[model samples]
Target: MVRRAGHLFAFLVVASTANAQMPPPTVGVIQLEAQAVPRSLVEPGRAMASAEVDIRPRVAGVVTEILYQAGRPVEAGDVLFRIEPSTYEADVRAAEADLAAARAAVKEAEAAVVRSERLLGTGTSQSTLDTARSTLEQARATLQSAEVARDLAQIDLERTSITSPITGIPGFAAVSVGDLVAANQADALATVTQLDPIDVEIWAPSARVLSLIEDISLDRVELAESITATLTLETGRAFEARGSMVATSQSVSETTGSRAARFRFENPRHILLPGMFVRADIVLGTANAILVPQSATEREPDGELTAWVVAEGRAVLRSLQEIGTHAHGWIVTEGVAAGELLAVDGLASLTPGLEVRTVPVELDEYGVVHDLRDAVAAGNVEAE
Candidate 1:
C-alpha cells in the first residue's frame, strides 16, 4: 500500500510539470470595428389588396342566376349575379303608362284652357277659366311626378343585373341561385379584391417612429430616397420584387405603442394574396454600428450571451446585448465596443484571465475569417 501511494504522488507531480511547461493555446481573433452598417426596421406584416369591394344587391329580388364563376377574375361592369327582373320590368311598364296618361291629361287641360280663353266673357264664365288654369297646373305637376317615377323604375330594372363596380377577382358567391336577397343586404353576394399593386401593411414600434421623425427633422436622412422594403414570405423564401413606402399613420396607437405603415408592391402576376403573412425589411438608412462574428458568441448556462475577447494579453468574457444580424454577423447594441479583439477560434480552452496567443484575422463579406498568417492581408487587425 505504501509503495502504491508513493507511485501515485510521483505520477501527479510529473503531470503537473508537463502541464506547466505547455505554452498558452493559440487563438484566432478579429478586431471588431464600427462600420457604416445599413440600418433597417424589420417587422411582421400582412398583405392586403389595394382595393376591395363587397358586391351587394341594390334591388330586392330572387337571384335568377350566378353570372360569374367563384374565385375568378372579373372586370368593372361585368355582371356577377342576376336578380329576377320580372317585378322591376312590370313596375317600369306601369310607370310608363302613368307617364303617358299624365301627358294626355296635360294636353287635355291645356286645350281646355285655350278653349275657355276663346270663350272669355261669353258662354264660358271667368270662374270656369280659373278652374281650367288650376287644373292645367295640377296636370303639369302630375307629369313631373310621373317622370320621376319612370326614371326610378328604369334604374331599379338596370340594377337587377348586379355588376362588379371595380376590376378585380371575385370571391365565392354568398348566395346561390333562387335565393331571395334584400336591397342593400348586410351580407355581400361576393367580394372582389384588386390584386395588382397590393398594399403591405407594416406595424413598427412607436419609439422607432419617433426616431425616424427626428432623423428627418434634422435632415440626417431623406425617407423618400433611403426608405425601401423587401418581403419574406411565411415559407422563408424572399419575394423577388421590391416595395416602396406609401405612408405612415398620423398617430401611434396608445395600446400597442406602434404606428401603422404601408408599402406598395407591384404584383403583376397576383402572386401575393390578401391576408398573407410576411416579414417586411424596411431599410431606413446606413449608420455606424459595432459588429461581431456570430461564431465568437456563446450563451452561458445562466442564459446570458457572451463573447470572448482579448484584453491586456488575456482572454476576457464580454456580455453582449445583440440587436440583430447584419452582413452575416451579429450587430451588438451593447457590451463589446468598437476595436475590441474578439476570439473567433480555439475557444475550448478559453477561460477568464487565461493568457492567449492571438493570430490576427480578417473577415470577408460573409463574415468568414481567414488567419492573416496563411492568407493575403486585407487589413491590419491589431489588439485593442
Candidate 2:
C-alpha cells in the first residue's frame, strides 16, 4: 500500500508539470501590414496665386462706364471704363488740320519755286530763287512737325478707352461711372488674379529635408522633376488637386531652422483662392518601420516608447525605435521585425513573462479591422 501511494503521487506530479509546461491560449495578435506612408508634420503658408495684380490703367480717365462687376472675370483688352475721349478727339482733329495746312503750304512753296525758276531762266534776279528755296525748306519742316503731332494725338486718343491689361478674375473696382480718374491714379480700376493654377507654399525643417535628399532617392519614380504633395483644405477635406514640389528656398531660415518649399497645384474650379491657408503632405521616403496599433503601446515615465511582445509564451517588454509616426500607428525604426507577431488586444493585464495562449488575428479586406476573439479563444486565446 505504501509503494502504490508513492507511485500515484509521482504520477500526479508529472501530470501537473506537463500541464504547466503547456502555454495558455493567446489573448490576441494582429498581423502587421506594410504600407507606404509619409511624415505628416505639416506647416501651412498663406499662398498667393500664380499672378496677382491691381488693374491700374497706364492712362487714366475714369468715371465713364464700369464694364465689369466686382469679382467678375475679365479678358485682356476688355474695356473696363470710358474716359472722356472728347478732349482726345479734339486734339486728334486739331493735329489732322495742322497736317493738312502744312501740306498746303508745301504745295504753295513748290509752285513759287517753279515760278521763280522760270523767272531765273527769263533773266530774273538771283534773290528770287533764294527766296523760293527758303520757303520750300520751311514748308518741309512744318510738314514733319505736323506728322509727329498727329501720331502723338492718335496715341492719346487710344488711351481714352480704359482697357483691361491682363486676363484674370477681377476684384473690387474703386471708381465708378462719371468719376474722374486722373492720369496714373493710384486707385485701381480692379484687381485681377490668375486662378486656374495656384501655388502651395510649405515650410519643412532644414535637417529633415537634407536627410531626405541624401537618403531618399533623387531619381525616385514619382520625383522625376518634383516631389508629390497632397493638400488639405481649410475644411479638413483633402483636395483632389495633386501638386508637385517646384521650388525650394536657397538657404535655411536662421530664425526657425525651417526652409520654404513651393508646390504647384491645379485649381480648375477656383475653389482655392489667393491667400488661402492650407496644409500639405510631403512624402519623403518609404521606411521599413515596425508599425502596431495604438492600443498595444504604452509610455513609460521616462518618455520612452514601450511595447509588449509575447516571447516563449511569456510577456516581453521592448523599447521602440526612434523613428517618427506613420498613418494610424507609430513607426518603430529598430527593435522589430517584418514578420513578427505583435499584441493587438488584451494589453490591459499584460506583464513580463506572463503565460498566454495566442490565436491568429487578421485584418479585413479593407485593412481596417481585427478580430481579437479569433486570436484568443477556443482557438485557445487566454491571458497571463
- Which structure among the candidates has the greatest lDDT? 1
What number of clashing residue pairs does each candidate have, in the order they appear? 0, 10
lDDT for model 2, please.
0.74
Q: What lDDT score is found at residue 367 in candidate 2?
A: 36
**Each prediction's Cα lDDT score?**
0.86, 0.74
Model 1, residue 25: distance off in Å is 9.9
Query: All candidates' TM-scores?
Result: 0.70, 0.70
* 1-384: candidate 1 lDDT, tens digit per residue: 999999999999999999999988888888788776666778989999999999999999999999888777889999999999999999999999999999999999999999999999989999999999999999999999999999999999999999999888999989899999999979999899998889999999988777767755754444456478999999999998999888878988899999988999999888899999999998887555677788778878998889999988899998986545665677676788887788998889998999988887777777677777644344444432
At residue 353, what lDDT does model 1 achieve?
98
**Candidate 1, 289: how far from true, in Å?**
6.8
